[model samples]
Target: MSPVDSNALNELYKAHLAEQQRRTEHALQRGGFDALLIASGIEKFAFLDDRPYVFQPNPHFKLWVPLIRHPDSWLVIRPGHKPRLVYVQPEDYWHVPPEAPSGFWVDHFELIVVRKPEEALPYLQVPGTLAIVGEADAALGDIVPNNPPEVLNPLHYARAAKTGYELLRLREASALGATAHLASQRAFGEGRSESAIHNAYLDACGFAERDLPYGNIVALNEHAAVLHYQYQDQQAPAQSLSLLVDAGAHSCGYASDITRTTGNGDASFQALIDAMEAAQLRLVDRVRAGVDYRDIHLASHRETAGVLRQLGIVKMDEEAMLAQGVTSTFLPHGIGHLLGLQVHDIGGFMAGEDGGTIAKPDGHPYLRLTRVLQPGMVVTIEPGLYFIPMLLDKLRATPAAANVDWALVKHLSAFGGVRIEDDVACRETGAPENLTRDAFAALI
Candidate 1:
């Protein structure tokens, strides 16, 4: 569990509706689209649907987004063209909650619905030319990007920069995640197991009055040595174990990314943690705007190398350590990704703007953010070090390991892993300020 604020969800849709109106107007101003068909964000498929796991009772009952521009408030293309809104069913009035603002639509546009979502296309004022307000199906021919496409993805170019209201919701969500992490920290001990720690997260999320975004990673002992290790991955030896939690809490749609590691109170483990924390700081510093993301990733890699070499894990040569592929054994996943409406936010690369890349190559393929950072953008800066036997086996099979002193790597292998992740916001002065509370970092 990351974090959540029930109050945010109550009024979130109204703000989204307002943004939808702005997007519709902007899309119409761009060209010759007669009408834009809108769809509810809720759907049958399990994950994408915003509804809770238990709410799958009715397939069509999913009313995620308010479909019509407005029932009475419809838009007509110069009084002759047809209006917008293609929906799942064409009958009952949408039950607008009392909190929702009224009158966002003009009566000119027709508010029509249909049993089959695809059937509404034929009714479009200009069937072949309408820009979709939501994700379109692939069966609709060249009208879409490539081949046949049916449903249109209502594109919102404006949502990339978060509004003040959105930031508040996001911060509320992050706090909940912090709460979960603290509770998880308590659940991990020698006799306790990974499942126990994972359950602790769910309990904490419940206590904080929020929902869990995804399952938690409660790796204990040697199991914790492997990054991303959950119950399905592996488990601890019941003793001499540490824990790593890669979990977040989502409120409405905003998410807070955070990771915490456990130590078995061993002296060597503390030294490994010392190195990992220092490397994490170096990586966290890279969250500033205008900094090349690739540079940040590499700087983190090099920083890890500095600490590792002093601990005698590898030779001091940064390039040589990289060439040996020893670093990949510990940290396989990317440091972080954009956080917002989705667990992995979009606008990675905009349509018309040139999104340049500075972070590239060797073990960084999953680097989600490729462009320079910008103010108002939220990102997680998570850096970790883990040890997995399979990865160690692979490194041993390679010739590069000849240069790697395995005895040194082996010494720290049993120490489990250390990861420290924090949510940050890019400032106007090209620096990232921590969105998490000061006390949280103080514990580190």
Candidate 2:
């Protein structure tokens, strides 16, 4: 069972509401609005007469209420006042009407249920005075005026720093996801096919495909070299060399992303995996409040180069290899990214609390995070080393090619790659807490 206490869920809910109110009030003042209306969003439909896609409550709306139902529910917020929920309960046999949630958060909001979403407009502030968020099409026509980026950007920026409640959900997510990783890892060792391993992971976590934070990446052997290896080959190789599983789980509305690599009795390949894991941990230790995330990413490259030298994969010193961009050939991706409601959470590159953005450094377009580390922020520290044939072929044609041992690369490439990812939480002091580590420890 998850370590998250049931009573704590209520406490988390209360804390979440406080944060939402704080963000909403600040946004309202900055955007020059007397009130804010956040919609739960409407269901989307596919081509022609296709059944509507499963409803995903607007992140903004879910931040305020746990209700995930469709039918265009809404939230009304004003400074120093109790918020209101314009609940929608459709009266139809085609689908079951959503019952009002009964929880610690429900009492905080003055609930008003209506048969149609438009009926709740009378309970809101004047159209022009209220700023609307969520689905633009779900708006009650002129009953609620829309607030553009100017109003939304502030809230988006504030979400980067999580509250105590959000952290708890994140911890639960990490702990749960670690269990799934353990199951998948064992399946690989048992010579299970990639598809079978993927199924084992989901079954262990009790989550459906759509319920996942993102699609699972279950790759075996050479297939691991593909950055976003999407295929889950039905057949397992006669001799399994390695396995890479990048998967995650959700708790409440938060997410935990984790990746692990395992070897199949290949001494050299196992050594590389151990080296990558150790280097990843050392990099994770660098996560602390006030540290620049980009610096951590660069540090990872330098460290990865050192590992390559130790394994005789790179001919030059770590510094020389980094300077020659040889490290990029092995570890091509950004060290990691922010983790939260969205897997690649928003505001990663936001310039400030209100708006603007910071561009990724040149030649590092895949880097997803750019902000300086701060307390209450959670991010993934994933460092990878791969012997990709395409990248290796390109490097083979370059002058820096001499820095690599082609024979070793050819032998190691068959084992694919190694990636060690952990969700880390920044602290006001000391080393950033390793959620993945704690999650795994909890299992024992």
Candidate 3:
């Protein structure tokens, strides 16, 4: 990434850091509490709003966590004349300075540091329902009603609720992810291996001025069904086949996840994929506040399965098909998760004061949602259909598999999977807007 890419984020982070203070002060007044505490790490909290504040051997350690005791803190600027910041120093970096640009938390907030904070910080000695955040869990202490949720842990809670500035940054990031995907998709059609396409994604990140987030999954045909399969140096097919690539980029400290599936295949397989894309369109265009996300997920699966069964891939009862948990034979993971500071970010599962909920499916132990949808939450609804041996075995062993069309399954077995994911902003008034879908389509 160029210096310009790094500088823009630095400016964005400063503005966000200022907002953290405003939110903290509001929390203190309303909760009748003393302030908040945050525990950070060098490798754990790797967020860069615009640029790195302190360059570390490990690049992901930079972050700004807030300590707020009340909800109103987000709206008020502390009653005290100025805000306070406890700047901890890693034992090794105790002598070096903050390592960030000038004027970072120097005037408005007090900066203090402690070594081995969990074992030695004087503030943790403060006796109140301390609402700890970030790495503050057991180190700062636990939360209790008598002690109360004074300190919010996982600072990601507030992060899940994007700021106007953050939304703008995310928009740009989404666009970049689309651009990268398209480049890699083109490489796929040209007979590039899955690894070749994967490299294209990294190159896109560099050119787009972003640090490549996580390694991407570029699966073609049977390889796509492996889900999360990383094809680092494998050969790619040259024939009409299905290509499933799940990739994204980390820009301005937020993550953008967008998946696209293209095919050089028979009419039947292509039609099946068209059905998957249609399901994505149906859900992406209507996700707003009050949406029971489970309904959306269920609908996507139901629709995908309906298409497969209609296409003669499955010879089972419609209701029983989904009930048997057969979708795993195709799409193995949750549609998607909350995307932000940490990729999966945080929140969306807990019952927040905001009353939003994203439910987790009992059958799919990994399904992360656990509450009803609410405004201010951003999530991905990536639904997929694949044909994997392990999952197929599990499903076929069940009584519900009796009617599945074995012949059709054989045909789709080589087709792999179809996944379409887009980042969506949940809103109060209308449908949630898709941030990555159009970009993905443009590439195809």
Instruction: Judging by lDDT against the true structure, name the best candidate.
Output: 2
For model 1, how does the per-residue alpha-carbon lDDT over 1-444 read when each residue is reduced to its tens digit? 233354554455446445445555455545445454333323333577745432111101112232212221111222234334443343446633223222323232355545543554465345445543333432232333221122112232344446555666577667778887888888775355566666677788763323455556666656666666647333435464566787888654466778877676777777887777777766776787777566777776777667667776655487777766567776777777666665566654433222223445566777776556777677778877766788878977876666566875666566566888877777778557676644265435
Residue-level lDDT of model 2, residues 409-432, one tens digit each, is 888999889998999999999989
TM-scores for every candidate against the unseen true structure: 0.71, 0.94, 0.74
**lDDT score, residue 327, model 3?**
64
Worst 10 residues of 1 by lDDT: 54-63
lDDT of 3 by residue, 37-92 (tens): 44343232347554433321111112343221111011112344353444543445
Candidate 1 residue-wise lDDT at 399: 69
> How would the candidate models be sorted by lDDT, starting from the highest?
2, 3, 1
Model 2: how far is 105 from its true place, Å? Answer: 2.7
Overall lDDT per candidate, in order of appearance: 0.57, 0.86, 0.62
